[model samples]
Target: MIDPILPFSSYSEEINSMLPETIQKELVFLIDSDFMDWKKIESILKKFPSISHSIVRRRLDVDFGRLSRRLTGKSIGVALSGGGAKGFAHLGLLKCFEENEIPVDMISGTSAGAIMGGLFAMGLDSSDILPLIRNFWLDRNLLGDFTFPFVSLVRGKRYSQAIHEFFKDRSIETLPIPFYAIACNLTKAERKVFDRGLLWKAVRSSTSIPGIFPPFAERGELFVDGGLLDNLPGSILKERGAGILISVDLGGGGQIDKDEMYHNLLGPHYLGEAPSFFNLLFHHLKRKL
Candidate 1:
C-alpha cells in the first residue's frame, strides 16, 4: 500500500533504517514533489543497499557501480513529444530501449505522448500496449464520433471514458515509475504539469485538442492539449536532475493534411495573439495549400 500524504518521517523503522542518507533525502524531496511511489522508492533502497554493503567482500569497486551512478546523478530521462497518431512510435522507442538494456529513470510527455508514457510508467511494456492500441485506441467509432460541435467536433465523453477504462483511475503518484503529463490551461493561458492526480484524467487532459476534442474542466480552469504550449517537455526532467535527456519530437513540421486544415479554425481559442508556434505554422501552411 502507498502512503498518499505521509512524509519520510512517518515511514516504518525498517524502511527508514534500510535507506541511505541520500535516498532518505530523496524520499523527502519526492514526497514534497507530490509525484512518487513509495514502492519504487523502497525497491531502489532494497536493491542498492545490498550491493553497497557487500561491494568490498564481492571484489566490486564502490566507486564505479550502481551506487556510484545513483550518487553521481546519471539517471536517464526520456521526453515524449505530442504527435497524435505519430506518438505510437514512443512504444517502439521504449521497446528498443528495453532491448538495448537502457532503463528509463524518469519520463515526461505531452498529448498522445502522455498516453504512451503513462502506460509505460504504470509498468506496461510496449508489447502489452500494442494490444491495447488495437482494441481501444484504434476504434473508429470511439474516436471518429461527431456531435453538434459546440466547443469541439466530438463530445469527448467517449474519449474520456476510454482513458479512464485504460488507466482504471490509478493515481499518478502510485505508479511504479516516475512520470509527468503536460497540459495547457485554456482559462489560465499557461502550461500545467500534472504530477499528482488520477492518471487517466491527466492523460485525457493532455490529449484534449482544442478543435478536435473538448477541453477538460478542473478546478474552474479548462485544460487542453499540452502540445498547444510545451509539446516537448524535456525541461521538466532536467529540472529534476536527470543527467541524460532524450527528447523525441514526433510532432515537428510536416506537410499539412486536409484533416488538419479543416480543424484549424473551429474556435477563437485556436486563433489568439499568442498561439502555439506549431499551430501558427500549421495555419500558415494551410493557406498556402
Candidate 2:
C-alpha cells in the first residue's frame, strides 16, 4: 500500500502568497548556490523564473508509482560513519533518498552520524533539517567552556546544552523510525549501542571525542566517541533485522601505518633530514590518542 502525499496544488497558492518577496528571493539564492547539486537543478532553474502555481501543480500530480521504485517488503537501513564535519554529507544522502521516494526503515550511526540519524528518526526530513542547522543551531556560540590541557580541550557544557535544546526532551524510543546511536564506554573500552533514553544525551555521548570534548558521565560510567570503537555501525543495523543495508563511511581510508604517515608527509623529494621533528611529534601523539 502506498501512502499519498498532500497534493502540491492544495496549498501552493496560499503558501506562495504568504511569503514576502525578500524571503522568497533569499530562498531562491540559497537553492542556486554552488555548494549543492540535486541533479534536477537545471529543470528547477528553467521553470522557476516564470513559475506558476497551476504549472507546479500540473507538474507534481504525476503517476508517482510509475516514476518511483515499487515498495517491496524489505527492511532498508542506513548506517552512517563518524568523521566530524564530514558527517554533514549524510544530509545530501538523505536528500537523495527523499527525492527517489525511498523509505528508510532503520538508521544507525556513530558520533556526528548519530546527530543526523536521530533528527531524521524524530520525523524531520533533509529539507527541514538543513535550514534549521544553517539558520540557527550552527550559528550558536558553542565554546562557552574551556579547560586546561588535560583530558580534553573543552568541558562541552555549551555543546551539550545546545543539543538538549534542539531535541526538546525527545526520547529515543518515541521516534517515528527505529534508530540506534553508538557510543563507547571509556572504562570498559567497549562499544555501547543506545536505542532508548534521552535523545540529546545519547548524541552528546556519541560525539564526545577523547582529547577534544570531555567524556560524558552517567551513573558512574564514562562515555566517549563511538568512533573510537565503531566508526561505521552497519553491523548493528544488520543484527537488528535490516535485509538491505546502505553504509555511508565518511572516514575515507582506514588507519594509516606509521611508515605511510611519514612517507605521505615527506612527499617525493625524500632528501629526508631524518623525518621532521613535528612528524615524530604527531606520530607519538597519534599513538597516544
**Highest-TM-score candidate:** 1
| Per-residue C-alpha lDDT of model 1 across residues 69-88, encoded as one tens digit per residue | 44578867899988777888
Residues 1-289 of candidate 2 have per-residue lDDT tens digits of 1111333344446545766766522112111112222223333323344431110111232222211221232567899888777778999999999999887777898988898999987768898999877754468766647878466677788888888888776767545466899997766667899986788999999988666678899999989778766778899988866778899877543222222322353233456456643344334444555
Query: Which structure among the candidates has the greatest lDDT?
Result: 1
Error of 2 at 189 (Å): 1.1
lDDT, residue 37, candidate 2: 28
How many steric overlaps are in each model, in order?
Answer: 0, 0
Full-model lDDT, candidate 1: 0.69
Model 2 TM-score, all chains together: 0.64
